[model samples]
Structure formats: C-alpha cells, structure tokens
Target chain A: MSKKIVIVGGGPAGTIVANLLTKKLKKEEASVTVIDKTGRHVYEPGLLYVTLSDQDPKGIVKDEKDILNKKVRLIVDEATKIDTKRKMVEMKSGNRFDYDYLIIATGARLCPEEVPGLKEAAYHFYTVDEALKLKDALEKFDKGKIVIGVGGVPYKCPPAPAEIACFLDYKLRKRKTRDKVEIHYLSPLPRIFPIESVDPIVNKIFEKEGIKYTTFFNVESVDPKRKEVHSLEGETIGYDLLILIPPHRGSKVIEDSGLGDRGGWVPTDRYTLKVKGYDDVYAIGDATDLPISKSGAAAHYEAKVVANNIASEIKGIESRDKYNGKVVCLCDAGNKAIYMIILQSPLVPDGSIVC
Target chain B: MSEEPKVDRLIDARNTFCPGPLMELIRAIKEAKVGEVIGVLSSDTGSKRDIPLWTSKAGHKLIGIYEKAGYAEIVVQKIK
Candidate 1:
C-alpha cells in the first residue's frame, strides 16, 4: 500500500507542503490529500488594497480546484477533529481520513465577536468578504470620521492597520472630502510599530500623513448606536465608520486536540516545526503560535523547514531543517513601499518587532 | 520553417510567498516557445488554484498535477 499523507487546512503552508511532497514521491510511493473548507483561496495581503477600493476584489480570490496538483486529492470540507494516536481526521461532513503523517495548516481567523459591540458596529478587512464589505461602506459614505483601530498585538500582517490608515488618508483626499473626514489610528502599543528601531521611520510616516495616532489605548468595548469606542485608558473615540483589525486565534480543532498552549496556538519546537507532544504531527503557519508575526510569508518559510524535517523522518534519516524565524514584510507607505526584515532571535527576545 | 521543439519545464513554487512563485512562472513561460510544457510546483494554497485558472484564461493547456510529500507540481503546456 502507498503511504498516505494528509494535510489539513489548504492555506499557504498546507498547499505548499502538498506540492513539494508530490515532487519527492513517485506515483506509487505516496498519495497526498489536502482538506479545506472554502473553495476560494483569497490573496489575504491584498485585502488592505481591497478595503480602500483600490484593487478589484475578484482579482484577489481564486478557485481552490484550479491550484491543486492533479495527483493530490483535494477535499473541500471542515476538519472537525484530529485523532493523532489513531492517525485519522474526522471532518464535519462525517468523513474520516487516515494518514501516515499529518500537517496542520489551518491559518488564523479574526474574531471580532470577542469584543462587545464590535461584531455589530465595526467592519473588518481581514478576509475577502470583509474587504468587499468595507469597500462598499467606504464608497457609500460621503464624509465622516473614519476610525482605524488595532484591537491588540500579534495580529496577522503587523503593518496592515497602518497601511490601511495611510490608504484611507489618500482615498479621502482623492474624494475631496479630506477637510470633512477625520482619520484616527488607535493602537495599544507605544508606537506605530512595536520594534523600537522601526518606530522612527513608521512614526515619521504617520506624522507626514496627518493621521491622528493614539498609543497605549486598549479598546474595551464599542457602542454601535453612539458610534463610540471606549478604551480601558478612560478615553473614547467616536467615528462614523470603524475599520478594525480584530484579535486572531488559532484553529478550534488545534485547541480541542489538546495540542495548543494557553493562548490556543499549537506549541512547537520553534526550530523544528514539530508539535511538542506528537512526533508524527506537525504544525505550520498561523496554526502554530510562533513568536513571529502570522503572515503568509512566515508560513511559506516555515513550511519549507517542516517539509524537509518530515521527509527526513519518513525516510529514516536525521532531520536537519531548522527554522531561523526569518520574516519579511512589505509595508505600503501611502504611495511608495517599504520592505522590512526582522530576524528571529531578536524578535523572540524582544517580542516587539513588527514582523 | 521548422516547428520548435516542445520543451517540458517544471517550476516549483510550493512554500513560496505571494507574487514570488506566480511572478516566476510568468517569466519562465515567457522565455519558453509555444508548444513548450511548463510545470509549476506550488503549494501556496492560492497558487494551486490560481495557476490553472490563469493558464486556461491565458490560452495554455494544463497537462497534469500531482502532490508529493509537502508540495504540489502542476504541469502546463504553453499554447500561446
């Protein structure tokens, strides 16, 4: 019988792993399977542009079937649970898949409901649907106070909120409503970006753009009717539209499988990408709460390391692939772009780098 | 005039971030002559689905796709 490899979550990490594995295995050696709930794969980073109505939403999303390797079985369903000991996964559709090795790539999801009144009042641009909704809202509103709030730290794409703020500034100006609409950026961190070194550059950009910046203002709750956001620091900001980057959490399946830490992210050897408790199971992307920012690029690099290690283990060889926690981010600084690089050691030690 | 030999090329983009693999595939295809086969190896969930769709719309033929240990290899025959 051929070796069966099952990958959960058809995001960047899972898909990348599946593709690489197919290249290594012959037709009779191994069979790869990928499972995802959605049929559409959206370019998540493009959401910032989508929210500003700068990019066509359709261009950012693609059909999942079109990307899968012909050899891999693409299963479209929700993964309800993982039975590591039994080496099987139970799906919401009541189908169970048995595997010799399992890779979890289910990325993070934004949970606005975690904060009171946020689900009802605020709009999010984390997903394709959310971005489209935000685009529509922004286009319809003539002139009003637009508040861009950073719900908490460790959100995916650290620079997204700031990028969106800058884009909104330009958008409002292009609409000739700059004088009427006020844009405010609220964050819990002391500076625009947590990394002290990068703050000087980011802070300068914020000032040059004329965006009102409030630091150390932790959002407590939101009142939709009053269009107000109350912070734990005893300050309130009122706005006609709220574009929020909500707190992110790990997959519920990972938490329920007992593989997650206190924050619900899978705990793994930062260098190995191996789940702490299970040898046959590995986690990648936002599913594993590594110290680095949870972005597609991080997932891609982590997947490379995990794939090599997993391949070595399968072949009865010593695994040598190790993650160095490298991260690269493309910050859209209004009209131009800034490419930032953050190494792993400094990030893990300081825990303030804007990855 | 003689017909150009169809070259079979496989481009692996698995585990590569956005715009990286896609951009590379476009460049590789452009360098190849018509009737040449270009295989893309991408595991970025988005690319697995996007490449074929884009290839078909761009007038290319998808030969086959297969998955190995951790990535997917998609073969495309450039027609235009």
Candidate 2:
C-alpha cells in the first residue's frame, strides 16, 4: 500500500515539496497531493517590479497546475479543516483527503481592514490587483508628500517598504519631479530595518536618496478625511499619497482549524519544521512562527529540509537534515544596484553584497 | 604557507542562483564520509560568502576557497 502524503496550500513551499516528493519517492512508495484554494499561482517577487515598472502582469501569473509536476495531484479547493486525530483534511467542497503525513504551507494573509480606514484610504501592492491599482495611482501623482507607512509588524517582505521608497524616488527623478515631492518611510521598529547590520547600509542609501524615515511609528489608524496617518504614540504624519503596508496574519484556515496561535501563525519547530506537539504534521514558509523574515527564499530553503526528511522517513532511512533558518534575498535599490542579504539566523545577516 | 588540500569529491553547481550552490554542497556533505574533502563550484557570488559561513557553522573544516575564472571552487572537509 502506498503512503498518502497531502500538502495544504500550493504556494511556493508546498509546490516545491510536492514536486520534490515525486523525485524522491517511487510510485509504489507514496502518492502526493496538493490542495490549493485557487488554481492560480502568482510570482510574488515580481509584484515589486510590476508596481514599480510597466511590467506586464501576464508574466507574473501562472496556473498552479502548470507549475506542479505531473505526478502530483492538485485539488483546486479550499481546505476547511484538518482533523489531526483522524489524519484527514476536509475541504470546503465537501471533499476529504486521508493522509499518513500532512504538510501545511498555507502562507500569510494581508488584513488591510484590521487598521481603521486603511482598506478604503491606503494603497498597497501585496497582491496582483493591489499592485496594478497602486501603479495607476503612482502615474497620476506629480508633486505631493508621499508617505510609505507600515501598519504593523510581521508583514510580508521586510525590505519591500524600503525598496518602494527608493523606486518611487527614482521614478520621480526620472520624471523631473524629484525636488517637488517629499518621500518618507515609516517603520514600527526603532531602526530603518529589523536587521541591525543591514540598517546602516539602508540608512546610507536613504540619506543619499533624500528619503526621510520615521522609526517607532506603529500605525494605529488612517485618517482619510484629514489625509494623515495616526501612530500609537499619538504622532501624526500627513500624506498626499499613502502607501500603507498592511498587517498580515496566517491563513484563516489555520485559525478556523484551531492549529494556530492568536496571531494565526502555527507553532513550528525551528529545526525540524514540525508543528509543535504533532509529529506527523509539518508547517513551512510564512505559516510557521520562526521569528525569521517571511520571504520566498526562506520558504525555498525550508522546503528542501522538509522534503529530505520526509523522504527519508518514508523510505525507512534515518535522515538528520534540519532547517538552519537560512534566507537569501536580493533587494532592488532602484539605483542600478542590488543588495544581497544572507542570514544563518534571525535578525543577523551572515553576509551582504552591494552590486 | 599551507599547501592546497586535495579534492576528494567535486559538486559542480555553476550557473545556479543563490541557495542553489549552497544546497548542493549541503546535500553532498550529508552523503560524504568523515575526513573526505568535498568541493563545490559555484558561479553565484553570494555562495562565495555563504558557503564558508555555512561550513564553519556546520562544524566542518574549510580547506580553502579557490577562485577560478567566472566561478569559485569552495572546498570543505566533512568532520562529523
């Protein structure tokens, strides 16, 4: 009998694991299946380029089935609940999948409505629609105070807000309107970035670009009428155009399935990538509470670890592969240079490159 | 001056992106026996710094990083 392996969420992490399993396991050894809410998969990193440039949206969108290996089965349905006791997955379409091992890679969700007036007032680029909307908004603006504010912590892509500020400044300069506009970056942290080593490098770039920054500014609410952003500290910054990075939470399926914490992030073992107290269950990517940067690079490295270990377990071989919290990212500075940040741990960069 | 270490096995991960060369080296290290030297050729510049960092952190011996044309040969010895 073949072992049933079911992966929830056909995002980068899940898709990578499902494909790797096909290469690792023989047909008689296991059967792999992936459950995704939508059959579409967006190239998320390309969203930055889409918002900043006139890059066509079609290049960033791909059918999820097309990305997955032919050996793995893809279910275009939402996973409503996971019964850990029964080792089953219940879908919203009244479908169920029984599994010997379950991998949860359901990533985070952007909750713009969490902050008052944010959904209606602010602009974001976390999704395909949002990126296109923000791109249109950027084209019409010529001269005004453009404030890039972060609504809360644990948002996706830590370097994105800084990246957006640089790109916007460069765009305005190319338009011959650089001096007419003021660009400010707001963060909830005490520094420009969460990583101490990377902050000085970014601060230098901000200083040279004349992009002002405000730290310790936790966005409490957005005042659309006044065109101001109110912080928890009672400080308010007015903006003619507000690009707010909305707060993020883990997928609602995690919360509804009672597998997540208050913030909806699953309690996962940092090394083994296993959901805490569940040996047969594993979680990866932004779904885990690893205190690491929620980036695709992290998810890619994590998927390798999870896949290797699961394959060994299924083959009755002992494998000690563990996720060492590795994350490698190349951030665009919009100045003909890209910054590469690598981490062997949280909040510390093992190395960086400016090229 | 130390003599250049002999390469026991080589993993050619050239033309790959970040984490690609590093992952190939890691997987090769797992399959290697103790006291065997594993060399990985990576064109990705990020791996030039990351491979050494990973080798030291993983408690392996870093033989040397030999720079080649358009790529680098990162050699490490499996200690455990």
Give lDDT tens digits, candidate 1, residues A1-355: 5788899988878888888887767767778899999867888888887877568878888877777778888999999898988999999999999998889898886778767888889898998788889899988887778898766444787667877887777777778888888888986554565444566776876787778888656576899999999875568899899987786778888778776654467777677788877777888998875655678878888888877776666666874877866676677755545434443322232222343
Report the number of the highest-TM-score candidate: 2
Instruction: List iRMS (one decimal) for every candidate.
Output: 18.4, 15.7
Q: What is the TM-score of each candidate against the true structure?
A: 0.76, 0.79
Q: Candidate 2 chain A — worst ten consecutive residues by lDDT sum?
A: A346-355
Global lDDT of each model? 0.73, 0.82
Give the i-RMS of model 1 in Å. Answer: 18.4
Q: Which ten residues in a row have the lowest lDDT in candidate 1 chain A?
A: A343-352
State residue A147's C-alpha deviation in candidate 1, in Å: 1.1
Residue A140, candidate 2: C-alpha displacement in angstroms? 0.2
